[model samples]
Target: MQKVRGVVARAKGEPVSVETVLVPDPGPGEAVVQVQTCGVCHTDLHYREGGINDDFPFLLGHEAAGVVESVGEGVTNVAPGDFVILNWRAVCGDCRACRRGEPWYCFSTFNAEQRMTLEDGTELTPALGIGAFAEKTLVHSGQCTKVDPSASPAAVGLLGCGVMAGIGAAINTGAVGRGKSVAVIGCGGVGAAAVAGSALAGASRIIAVDLDDRKLEWARGLGATHTVNSKERDAVEAIQELTDGFGADVVIDAVGRPETWKQAFYARDLAGTVVLVGVPTPDMRIPDLPLIDVFGRGGALKSSWYGDCLPDRDFPMLVDLYQQGRLDLDAFVSERIGLDDVEAAFERMHHGDVLRSVVEL
Candidate 1:
């Protein structure tokens, strides 16, 4: 076992603390990563707030990139010194979903079999199966997808989650095509990514909707062809006006609230797609709508999970795209701080002050 400095969330609604934790050498099929950078995702905040569960003393960080430090007895895919992007879905080939040829929906994803423990020997649950806000972390060898080492870890690590979800929500789930009109609601990190993805996919008109004009300006930079401040105007009406008065070909709801969802439901052309990539709370419910609307809408209502991405295939491709200067992955990195600044980053996140605050290990 090796001791590494890490950030840990001890209790709900409490601040994260920097401390030393034990990371054991890799076991069979596992590897140890020397983490270079990790992104502060809202999901980490959800875990800190006990919104995910009561797993106290949670090891909070997931979206990350690193170099392989060591491999287990049977590991072969990556070697020491290889750069990699860590992922949660280390898919098990024998699972039902895998057998059905949809490994992305694998029911039996794997993580480090051994635990990273506190100094006092208390076991710590790694958030989202990846405890990455540290000097080193242990994960299944399959979780390490090798990518271009030249790419900035701070930029590519964001691809491990939110950015990937947004891009995938557009290019994958939304099935955006050449000349299609696409609109993304909630110009946050994920929503802005969706807009970028649409532009990359050759969407002719990419509309961005949000309450904050600042975010709308950011979205415009990210390839949104039109911007709508939803607070200032009816979002559905505004979207319709932009797409030849027929709404957009695809509408993505990055804000998962019922009201925003309703706007997305109505802000698409006939036979167009609606993709819900935003997350919703447990207590929220959709209001009554005529069943005829669902039938008359005449298209798919889809939900994107992690952009339905296949990491091994997608991560390397995205990194290459970033390297080519086609994807502005670096623009997403609004600020960089150490693991100790996570609590403060959360404060900024709550106030919508930044796109992403990355932690440099």
Candidate 2:
């Protein structure tokens, strides 16, 4: 067993604590990763707040990049010394989705069979099956996706979660193509990445909608052609006007709120796609809209889970693009912090003060 420092939420609505936890040696199909950096994503905060479930004493970091320290028997996909980004969706090839050749929707994703625990022998639930805010983490070997070691860990790790979600929302889920017009609501990490993805896809126009001017400015840097202050203007109207009065070819709702979702619903042209990438709380519901509008709109309405990404296929390609300087992955790193600062990062994220605050181990 290896004793390592890790961030844990002991209860709902309580601040996370850095505690020494015992990480067992990798069992079959498992691997141990020495985490280099992990991003403080909203999901981590949500897990701490009990938004995900009632699983207490949850290990809270998921977005991470690390070096493989060891692997257990039956693990051949990765080896010791490999640099990788941790992914939650470790496709199980025999599952229905994988059998259908859609591993991105793999019905049976893998995680380590063993559990990490506190010194007192309490089992700890790792967030998203990755609890990476620690100095080291144990995961299924399939969760580790090898990438170029030359890339910045802080920047590339974002691809493990929010960044990947946004890009996949545009390219994979929305099927954004050359000359298409795109609009992304909520100009945060995921939304801004969607704009960048749209631009990379050769979108003719990319509209970024957000309430914060700072986020809008950051969105412009990431290739948003137009910015809309939703608090000051009607987001749907602005998007429609920007898209030649017919609305954009694709509208992505990154905010996940009913109001923002409604805006995205009406801000697309007839037959255009609307991708809802933002996660909604269990208590939240889609507000009532005219049933005729859904039928008459004649376009696809879809939800993007983890941007519908296949990590094995997408991670390396995106890392290559970042190396080539075509994609500004660095723009997403607003700050670098220590593990102790994650609570502060949560506050900054809540206030829209930073795109991402990476915790360097």
Candidate 3:
């Protein structure tokens, strides 16, 4: 066993602190990773708010890149010294999703069998099964996807979560491609990434919509052809005007709210795709809309889970693109911070000023 300083949320609505955490040696199907860079994700903030569950004293970071420190028996997918991005989806090859060749939706994904604990021996519930806001963390071997060592750890680590989700929402779920007209609602990290993904897939017109002009500027840097300040005008009408009175070919709802979702539903050309990538609270229901409209004007209505990405296939590929300069992964990282700065980072989330604040261990 080894002890490391880690960010821990001891209770709901309380500040997270760097605590002494005990990490066990990896057991079967497990590996210990020395985290190099971990992005301050909104999900981590969600865990702290008790919004995810009553799982208290949670270990609070997930989007991370690291090096393998040790592996348990029978592990061969990655090894010590390998550069990797820690993923939450460790697909069970025998699950129904995997057998049918859609392992990205693997219903039986696994995590480390053992637990990391506090000095008093209380178990820590890791956010998304990856508690990487520390010097080292334990995870299922399958969660460690090997990527190019040459890429910046801070830049590529984001592929583990929001960045990947946004990109995947565009390329994989929305099927955005050459000459497609796309509009992504919510110009946050994920939305910006969707804009970038549309460009990467050769989309002709990419319109970015957000309340904040700052985030809209960030979207432009990432390849948005036009910007829409939805707070100033109706999102659907602006999207229609930009798309020549029709609508976007693909509309992504990254805001995950009833109003934004309805806008996305209307901001599409007939037989166009609408993707819901934003996470909505349990109480939030689908907005009141006619059932006939859903049937009449739809190519597809889809909800993107992890952007329907298979990390092993996607992570390395995206990292390679970043390494080659075809994809500007670095633009998403607005600030570099230390572990102690996470609480302040979480506070910064409310204002929506930053794209990403990455913690370098």
lDDT of each: 0.92, 0.95, 0.95
**Candidate 1 residue-wise lDDT, 69-111, digit = tens:** 9999998889999999999888888999999999877889989
Weakest 10 consecutive residues, lDDT, candidate 1?
280-289
Q: Cα miss at 269, model 3 (Å)?
A: 0.8
Provide the lowest-lDDT 10-residue window in model 3.
346-355
Please name the candidate that would achieve the greatest lDDT relative to the true structure: 2
Sort all candidates by lDDT, best to worst. Answer: 2, 3, 1
lDDT of 3: 0.95
* lDDT by residue (tens digit), candidate 3, 166-245: 99999999999999999999999889999999999999999999999999999999999999998899999999999999
- Tens-place lDDT per residue, model 2, 1-361, is 9999999999999988999989999999999999999999999999998899988999889999999999999988899999999999999999889999999999899999999999999999999999999999999999999999999999999999999999999999999999999999998999999999999899999999999999999999999999999899999999999888999999999999998899999999999999999999988889889999999999999999999999999999999999999999999999999989999899999999999999999
TM-score (C-alpha, index-matched) for candidate 1: 0.98
Report the candidate with higher TM-score, 1 versus 3. 3
